[model samples]
Target: MTPVSAPPIATASITGLVLAGGRGQRMGGADKGLQMLHGKPLAAHVLARLAPQVGVLSISANRNGDAYAALGAPWRAGVLADTLPGFPGPLAGLLAGLRAAQTEWLLTAPCDSPWLPADLAERLTHAALSARADIVTATTTNAAGEVSLHPVFALVRTSLADDLAAFLCAGERKVRAWYARHTAAEVAFADERAFYNINSLQELAELERA
Candidate 1:
């Protein structure tokens, strides 16, 4: 008998959030998400790739909400600001996304990773359902066969919003630490370049030139 595979998660059941709410110290304090890559904002590139993968789209921007909102206009995406002050980190953004999302799952990716895999949400959702995990993140293996975890590229249940809020209230800012508290699974992708995140103006230039 042929084994039946689990059905793919409905795109409408997941909300996508681009974590653009960073201090951008590496980019000389300039908003990293606003940095242009190939004549478009880096976050714009991310949003373009992410928008089709989920039912709703949102941006986690601490600055330049208007610009982000405009970028999101194509998808009618919501622009969210971190509830916790001082640009707490991606977890804060995750918290905001979780709270605002009407979907069962929230898929997150950093704004600077314009080349994020198109299959990110589908793969993560599959891993989450298979493992019965609360959170699922992406991983990649380097040329040397060293595995690296990309915790920021994750899918989490919106149900964890309260737990995340409490964790942030207690000053726990680490992303991996919060995931450790839950049942988390990791899905490996073959292409490492798909997850590349531009950190500085120099890196953006390098990527553009490449």
Candidate 2:
């Protein structure tokens, strides 16, 4: 796919949901989203991209509302119980985001992806609508020619809460597996670097260097 700008869409009509909770074991056990990058929290970068595009929004986190709350966006705690016992994962978080979402369209993204394109929400929404799909995923490339989807960076119908809730209850935690159960498209990123996900301290350090 050729790289292109993310022209705006119906920002006043959709909802933005930030996934802010993670075990962060890779960063030596801290809230990865709260980690400071350039003296600012990573969550700050996510909120900035999300706030201008959606009319309503919330953060889906676990264990620490106070810090998540300070971002000044309403927050939804991860419903660990919402997923099948012993299979807790991002599906549970998405369930919570979908439940709390108040718009027809819901945009979900993680807090640690700092360099996401400015028009991510709009482009994802556009892809979703054009495909006539229930969901649209953002995929980016790597130097090894591997293209991966940021499952968190998806545009879904808020009404799918029931479908998502049912999926989470079936002992399914893998996002791609759950996403496969629907008619979805992988929207390739023209600039693969934008889909980078920071999972470890070393990765974050490398990102800082870049």
Candidate 3:
């Protein structure tokens, strides 16, 4: 598919946050973001693909802040998962990133998805702005041809940080639970492989060979 041109939204008002704070239990507890994919760590690939899509780029990592900083991004900033306790999932990363982000919008992408599309931010921003929605997430078709939401691959309004903090404080962890309270828009992509994330060594190896 042909890539879309950059949308009319100001790039400086949006920040890209790479979600690298996962526990990675499926990969034998290895840092999934740091795992090698085609001789480059997964985070590096993600950063390379996402950096140009925003004005600033930062990483939300629970560990190895130094390594993620070394991913060759000159405009990089690092935010530790400190908003909530006990690795409270991707929302914690999102909260911490929201606190650190200077932009009005925050775009999040998983560090494990090395082949993320180049027009992700542009498309999401376009969709959100058109619908006047607070959250815009990426959706892709599965093998059965059914479209599904990928919450981690989302563009959110940073103004909802306090609402998110309250939600987490109430012990709610499911992303959809919080999503239900907001007006969200989904921008679907035709290529299912674009949303495929590596959760295990076998999947990583298969992606490498593919």
Candidate 4:
């Protein structure tokens, strides 16, 4: 009898989701994902990095769906809108991702973080599987020994969709708070720059100059 080999991690059981549903108030209300970054949209950069790490891909955007849809075209990524209205928050985007993903796990990163680490999904999935956790989030330590949790960069089980939806319905918008209620693990990353997110136009300009 011939033995079969498992599929590569890139086409295994994970789906990548880029969170771009924010109001972008800090960017002067501009669509941050649509913003130009090195001649391409910011979300495009995120998708390019994330698409190869998962079996499927998606984008969470509240407005300008057409533009986001265009950015997702190369990957055949689904563009999801918040089922709940009023531009709630990233949690809303997460909920949409959890529901839309066809894979057992969903890996997420903010669209603004164009420099997100390429190993994000691999590391998080390894941690989650090893710890048998429902969620795995990325964390970074500063020179001063301060640990910062980047909750937006996370891997979650699709089975938690119901629980997340309930939490959102209870008016809970806090990502860490919701995470605390689940079996969560934190994976430390050495490169903090990989997680740096541009919040303002000035920051974008500075990064561009860099």
Candidate 5:
């Protein structure tokens, strides 16, 4: 009898998701992603940096999906946010993206964080795979040498969608708390300023001036 060969395993493919679903209450209820940063909408900068790093991309916005669609690169036209009600925060975005993802992995970044690293997806993917972790997040050290995890900036397995959905249904919304339930890895980035996000008018001004 001839011996049977095992099937080849499929390689992982990553899709990018930009989280822009916040109400921007701190920025006076404005659409923060559409707000200006260096003469461009903040999401534009993020899209430019993140588009080249993934196979496909999507955004998560509670409103103004048309404006977000317009900011997508030429090749990425027609891409729009997966709308979810109530703006349950970044986790809702993550869950929506995961459920909608066409790939095995989902890489996420916030729209208001314009200066995200060009290597964000690559590094997070590497860390997760190397550590055999379910999730990998970008981390940065502040001037005081305090390390902080940017939970929204991460590479996550799409397979965790059910688990995340359950977590959310249980009223658990904290990103860190959810990550704690899984095997997670962290990759440190040297630039602390890279993670500086625009949460208010003053913060936007600081980034604009820089």
Candidate 6:
């Protein structure tokens, strides 16, 4: 896959946040982020990429603190922030991250997706800045160039937390639904394999081999 140049990644604009709060139901209800990918925990691999890109590294873990705390990064517990109808999910974690971020930009990736690109945070931030976007997300394609979107891989403004929280209160829970109301850029990863989230034990097994 050909890499597109992400607009200039000014180090001043972004803070990294890893969303780790999901209740991992598919992998037998275990903490999927805590599961080992190789020699290290899944979240650890994400932390390696995350801590380097932003001035601060924050983990959004809902129910487990010691489990996630041992990773040694600053952690924030996700609240039942979604006042929206049907129990809004990881958006709760995203809301927590945006609240904790002090920087102008917040770059986020799901904890279960450990193989996210090294320049992910930087690239997403650049994509947003370059397009004068409200938010920026990662996209990738297969050999045929069919685009796939990964909304969890995003760079957003800290200022949007209120809007997002308000959206939740208004009974809008889906991330894509809220994102549709804003200007967003999809920075293609150009490689579909790069953004897969290990939501199931089957995928975790595959990641171990990768």
Please write out the lDDT profile of model 1 over residues 1-210, one tens digit for every residue.
543332278888989999999999999999999998889999989988888788889999898999888875667558999999898889999999999999899999999998998888878888988999999999999999999999999999999999999999998999999999999999999999999988888988888898
Displacement of residue 175 (Cα, Å) in model 2 is 1.0
Instruction: Provide the RMSD of all predictions against the true structure, rounded to 1 decimal.
Output: 3.6, 3.7, 1.5, 4.5, 7.6, 3.6
lDDT of 4 by residue, 30-66 (tens): 9999988788989999988787787878999999998
Q: What's the candidate order when arranged by decreasing lDDT?
A: 1, 3, 4, 5, 6, 2
Q: lDDT per residue, candidate 5, 14-64, as tens digits?
A: 788888888999999999999998899998888887877777788888788
Better of 2 and 5 by lDDT: 5
Question: What is the Å distance of residue 172 in model 5 from its true position?
Answer: 1.5
Query: Where's the lowest-lDDT run of ten residues in candidate 3?
Result: 77-86
The residue-level lDDT of candidate 2 at 99 comes to 75
TM-score of each prediction: 0.95, 0.85, 0.95, 0.93, 0.88, 0.86
Give a tens-digit lDDT track for model 6, residues 118-169.
Answer: 7776677767767999899888878876778899888888889898888877
Candidate 3 has an lDDT of 0.88
Residue-level lDDT tens digits of model 3 in 46-89: 98988888888999988888888888658686655656668889
What candidate 3 gets wrong by more than 4 Å, as runs, is: 1-3
Residue ranges of candidate 5 with Cα displaced over 4 Å: 1-12, 73-84
User: Residue 99 deviation, candidate 5, in Å?
Assistant: 0.8
Q: Return model 3's CA RMSD, one decimal.
A: 1.5
- The clash count of every prediction, one per candidate, is 0, 0, 0, 0, 0, 0
Report model 4's TM-score to 2 decimal places.
0.93
Model 1's lDDT to the true fold? 0.90
Clashing pairs in 6: none
Screening candidate 5 with a backbone cut-off below 3 angstroms (N, C-alpha, C), the clashing residue pairs are: none
lDDT of 5 at 146: 85
Worst 10-residue lDDT window for candidate 1 reads 1-10
